[model samples]
Target: MHIEKNILDNVNIWLTPTFDEKTQTEIKEMMTSSPKELEESFYKNLEFGTGGMRGVMGVGTNRINKYTLGKNTQGISDYMKTAFPGEELKVVIAYDCRHNSDTLAKVVADVFSANGIKVYLFSELRPTPELSFALKYLNCHAGIVLTASHNPPEYNGYKVYWQDGGQLVPPQDGEIIQVIEALTYDQINFKANENLIEYIDAKIDEAFVKSTIENASFDTPAEAKDNLNIVYTSLHGTSIKSIPDVLSKAGYSNVNIVPEQAIPDGNFPTVKSPNPEEPEALTMALALAEKLNADIVVGTDPDADRLGVAVRDNDGKMVLLNGNQTMVLMTAFLLEQWKKAGKITGTEFIGSTIVSTPMMLELASAYGIECKVGLTGFKWIAKMIKDFPNQKFIGGGEESFGFMVGDAVRDKDAVGATLLICEIAAQAKANGSSLYKELQNLYVDHGFYKEYLISLTKKGIEGANEIKQMMIDLREKPLKEINGQRVIMVEDYDNSTARNLFTDEIEELKIPKSNVLIYYLEDGTKICARPSGTEPKIKFYFSVNEPLDSIENAKEVENNLDQKIKNIIAEMQLQ
Candidate 1:
């Protein structure tokens, strides 16, 4: 019922004439009628995280609004001018189908154009990966895409990409944040220079689709493509604009779109959430797949940077694959493609997150390539491409439903990934195998690995404190065992140290510092605790594996692994 003094002070500033009349009126209404909402909005400034800023859309300091994004653009404009002095600084802008994304993108473009930076804006909504491709294609200094990437309907976001077409990382992200922090909202230049802004049309789209098809297709026979019955859905997001085009151009003619979820609507009327990671979001797509007796079903998030896939199991029933399962399938398929082409000469590598199944390392070893594991987020995987300049980046993905094929687009690209998965499916079908069968083969060759994710969301100030305390407790009073499995090692990414519980040996982690902790069990199970950098949630990742002697017992083995995870969760009292 009571608001803090600092929150009240922040709110009162928004009521002044310095802000627009509508914003002022909204602030006043929140203060008088809904103090809790006002507190939530003005308690703190929305942070520009390493990837970018994302929050609910509202008239507050912690919201994604014109002034917040305008200030970010202005800061980036200033930073780019300094970073690339005396050069013709250019930036590409794109937006998703989120509400006000178009207007907000225009406002950002106006800020950049007003600052004398040349701007190339997408004439319409496009996939987030295309924006990354266009940034490098245009040889621009930076890129911005306005998308919440499958968050709730009330949310929006801004993600900044560098010249390498990867999201901002390390020193650059920190430097930009410092500059933006030094300025106020009024300092943003909203004036537009029409001459400096150029709207790009279908030319870039054609180039992007061509590049995706070229990079993803492995020359599957035309008969195989025709035999692969595919059902696709955009989940009421931006993929509707380009997915079908890419699939068609790639010579796949049997693609069926989920009609109820095909339109690009910000309201996302057809699903509970636009995120493909959630199974409920794919209900309509799954139904359509069953009706058509489709061999595979593919769905993309709002921005199309991530995808969720479904394939028929050995029993001939449609089953949705988790992010880790999809990652494993895609990574293994790409590695095999490279090997078959004699491209695996030992300098090639793939990228994955630490929280992902360690099966990636097994796959990498079998192919005689390296698996570079980084912290969570595709940005770090993108960093891998930039970090290892000489070694080839075949493909990479995280436990989250994201995959990036090759280095064409330095972000997770569902557009290209969809085509790549189809190639795998089509080729397998032609060879008397299904996608699920290929996955089973992978598990048999390289030990069967099962992964599960649990996210605990705590909202508002009290929730933030609770999450912080939870991490502290985990550090101070560490778990020695889970479900009677002895803890063999503990990896504290926050402290950048890995301790061997048995011998008490500590070694420094050679990666960037993140607030993540992982425990390795003697039974080859890995448990990780990490707080979401972009959301108000703490995620626990569990990976358990077993040696599969034969594919015949794969089902029974998988069931035991599933029960093991459930027992571990119950033992940890996380339920």
Candidate 2:
């Protein structure tokens, strides 16, 4: 329950800070509230790791506040000067509707401006993808978005992007971390230089809308504009302002919005979690879809960077599509369209996370092109594109519903996804096909693939230790089978190697070391386990596949796959 010593003491001398009355009052309140809570809040500064700084909003070193934001900005500014000295460095900044998000964004802008960097700041709320596009559109050196994606209302974060407009990667990520950890709290200049910061608004949005639609457009129109019924919800976040407009511009006249969930409320009034991946989160949207008798329903997370979708099946029952299904659906639609246009001259390559549905790889192979798999983050996908400058990257996505469809931006793009999903729906309807039918078509041709994701949460001080212990236990004792099939191989991403139990062989994985474990079964089952870097939880991904026959039995086969997955997890005792 105490501070982890020697772990971060090398920077202890920089802990003492100077702050104003509001910040002082908050800290004093925390100090008076159970000495244990104070240590938990101030024992260490919020981390600037691969995903940038994310934590609960509070007034301490371990919390996310103006001071922490300023320090992070100052460190980024310092690193920028070294990375590009004597150059006019500019950073595009955007924020979500999270508590004090705009205030923290302004703190970031002030720190950058004080460091003599140019700032392209949003005058109002916008999706995180727009921030990524702004970096490329404005030709800024990097970008930052103040959001924690779908995390709880109490959490906020700072996501750093590179010149590529994606999250920072590789040597740069490590270099920035080093720069951030070395800064003295007193050295960060929080003074505003308003003259250097420009407030940006809808003008940028106009450009984003055009680029998003143009990229998602097809050669010819599908059916009548009102033929498709679509329902959408922003989940009480930032997308409400733009999604309707985007769909209208894309020629979808029957788009219906979930009235109650349209507003940008940080409390997320209706749902336990704002994440669209949860069925509960999509309850309101689905109800509206059912009432409107819509063809498709969709929702986005708080920042609108991640997306979720659902559609009606042949049985007339509505079901939500997981991240993998969404990606596979989108990829199949896009690739088929582009191939018909002859846009891909065999030089194009697409990318997705290794944890994403393997269905994409099969889909890509069917088209006779390359499908590269990156680590579980889109930063790695962007890195792959950057590493191969000559290869054309049509789209890339992760299993978390974060997708970047065009080369114009490096981050996951909800705008592009919005238009793409609508287009896919239109294409299906025009071809007398449903999204479910198209998915089954792919399954029938390339074999059926099913995937599942499970997350285990650990809370408070004991949670971290418990997660660590779980990882230790898994590594020490490997499972021989998952639901009857013999174990084929185990890929321990932590050590960056895959071990084949049959041959007693070990092969190197291309990516760097990360604390992840994967257990593969001979029957095409995959289970991936990793502790969350920011939150107090561990996530496990399960994937299993089988053959697909006639569409009539697709439902039964799907239920079978679901039960098989459950049995596998039960054998593993994750239940």
Candidate 3:
């Protein structure tokens, strides 16, 4: 294998004394024995995208190691000083169960504290959402969480949050990247300011639990809660720290935790992946639900920002709901609650992503509120809350199993969302219906909608180029028809414009520029193609819907919609 000069230069820099001895040895060993791996490790500097960075843990510039994280923290510290001049700077730090997350977190804290920033470090592993909450609660300038939510065991990540408890977005993210890019690894200050670091545990945890319970609980009767047998799993992540307590304090007593997955372990030994979005990840929880005859089964991803839920269908069989289904159910419930409280004063809005189901628009229309759609990540959804001060953000969710109940956290919160889902399930049950039945009713009232996601993973440099080319091809030669449905309008988010195919009229998109494209068919189907900002994959989202005349035919309508999605996939050759 031939290595580029720049890559070799990067590798040689790591072999120098500026880096630690162990990292140097690993570099030399890779050079002699594994040139391909060595080339892959240093092909390019790991990108710090809009929301921090995540990659496999290794001894290279392109990996998540002590040095990479140290460089990032040092740069962020420098930028913070300029962004907030002369104000006493403070930040909160939290880590997940990933290997070396604690040590890496300490490294980050060391850099921040060295720069005279006060640091509140979690004494134990905590969920990513709590980090968001803790930052705002402590009145800090910024926050950092060391977690790779739902990624493989070999991966780790660092996500940067602003003072508003949301991930970095737009001009701030771009500016920070510029500052970080101008520096070398040797510029990192690893010296610790011992007095500037404080370990926090009980007080913040108590406050976060209280806030979660208060925001998510909506006066469900105690009998309804007791009758709803619930099975919960953390999937070897950090949700166990807060969810159980939140549920207990919210007056839900009958909860069973999956014994095999209850303990926090980064290895995620119980399942193929710790992602609750995958059915396999919830296998153990599903089994426990069956054994307990539970009414609902809930599981959160490793960092607990996203949750996957399973509810009893009309046939008395447990069925797992996808991210979109969960989001629709949750968002609609929140809107109804707000309406009941007479809080919907026409200034409230719900948030979702462009790639999410358009059914969200239907729900928003039904409730007489605006459903503001942004790019693919929850950071954009969080930005919606910050961008609109006067408009009340009732709640929002993405198609990726993440939901934020209110503005308290400013990020996707599984703890609060879990409590909210349980409330919905319990109330539905008390009203002579189940969660699944309520879904069917929703479909009948609105329209039967089905969504499916196709994600293709390509690894290494070659894979990166391949994914880029795939997007380019999609843009250069746009699809005119999908499954014989005429393409009425095309939304190219990269250019921030939508073109009406029938009229050839171009209109500006108010959302920010992103590498995403959506096609609207004449028959009301929506297809969106977007490359993953955090992972080595490209995702295609298909949403197909039809009018359901009655609840009796909901299942058949859903099956037809599912088939429509499959047909579109086959037509696009995405299989």
Candidate 4:
């Protein structure tokens, strides 16, 4: 544990906080643990990395708590006052249904209020994108949303958004970290100026919904909306109000919220994980869809930014769509509608993360729109829009179910995504075409892009060390081949360079330094490997593309592609 002496001193002080007996008792138990364990826990401070603070909930400097949240907020308020000076800076605050999420939101509000910054705090739980939209709608200088997104039950986090409603990147991330590093435990003022903190409720919600509806492009009539029998679930988080209301107002009357998971509960009682990407998380939603013979089953994570969906195939069996498939459907739907609705003019653009499905580029290109790839986070998506105000952003998404629609918000928005998705579903239903069929058509028009994500979980301090070593080994000796194909290019995102292994040509990467490596084969196969920033897991993304001559061969090509992916995984020692 390479830790600063000042950081070490600070840990000791936090472990001995004079606030409550409960925290003191917990710290006593940790102090009495194995010497090595105690050292690992207290040695270093939790870093406010690229996306901000995300960690297990506990009583430590390396954990998410009122103190850390306070420090981060105070630093941010200070930065905002400097960045957007001569203006009365206000901030919009929202929280998911995570445990202590409301408490953390209030903590941030109080901290900001003490700084004499006006705070618009959501009265009830809300999705991440709503916080983003609220920031823009209220014309606030910045925003914060309390959510770890789809992290495990023990985890909670805070995502900082610039005035544009996207997460901070590059200079901003570094600048905020600098400001936070200057904050001591005593420097964070948790005391609130009651007058400066306003509890916002229905007025904002109504205005937000109105703005969403005005922005949305719906093609179906209210009479045809009932044809789209959609089964929706929040997975026991914060999407309940926003998603349903958005769909209803968009003229889709047949949307049904999953009974068991409709309500917000931080414990997420029904599912082992609250993430929609997990099949078990959608178990109840799937069964309900099956019983109701619904067109699709959609699930949103706790924060409601990332959306997952399943559609009924020709066989009448409900099929789960991976992140890439969902991206293709949504991106294609938006581009098609945006053009017909006169929204795709001038420097129209779309965005996606490099690790996301490449189908976005294929669709955007077909639409004559420029598609830009960002680093893994959605902040870059928002930043690009900010940089190019003349360009209209259609939509952007990652394969992990996070999608951003329009230029209104910078982050992945389940609120707007849900509304837009419902409209897409309604259009298909009106035309007697299901989303599943529409997806197959996209696969036919664009090359079928199949992607598989494999993650290896490594827990605790020793696990992190192992991950570091793995990256070191890969950097030292790169892979030569995978599944009988020559590795043509090696892209080391950490070094911000790509080397053509065969020709020995090198080029610069546009993104910041991150410990990620991607190998591109001669046949266009891509395999990306990187460790998760917020979780103790390393993920490998495998992508393969094959042309579909006709709809009949979709199954055969899919089968061959699946086997090919498995062979490549085994060759790379990832299986």
Question: Model 4, poorest ten-residue lDDT window?
Answer: 34-43
lDDT of 1 by residue, 90-167 (tens): 999999999999999999999999999999999999999999999999999999999989889999999999999999
Residue 177 deviation, candidate 1, in Å?
A: 0.2
Where does model 4 exceed 4 Å of error? 1-10, 15-22, 33-37, 342-346
Regions more than 4 Å wrong, model 1:
none
Candidate 2, poorest ten consecutive residues by summed lDDT:
7-16
Deviation of model 1 at 217, angstroms: 0.3
Across 1-575, the per-residue lDDT of candidate 4 in tens digits comes to 34557645755677554334676566667656644445555656677554567888877677888887888999998898899888998998999888999998999999999999999999999878778888888899888989888888778998888877778777888988898998777788888998999898798788777777766656568766777788999998888868778777777788888888888888889988888888888899999998899888889999988888888887889989888888788889878887887877748988888798878888888988899987787788888899888787888888888887787767888778777777777778778877888888898999888999998999877889898888888889988988999999999999899999999999999877888999999988998988987788888999999999888888999998999999998877876
lDDT tens digits, residues 68-91, model 2? 888888989999999998888999
Q: Pairing residues by index, what is the TM-score of model 4?
A: 0.96
Indicate which candidate wins on lDDT.
Answer: 1
Candidate 3 TM-score to native = 0.99
Report how far off residue 390 is in candidate 3 (Å). 0.4
Q: How high a TM-score does candidate 1 get?
A: 0.99
The CA lDDT at 225 in model 1 is 97
Model 1: weakest 10-residue lDDT segment is 45-54
**Off by more than 4 A, model 3:** none
TM-score, one value per model: 0.99, 0.96, 0.99, 0.96
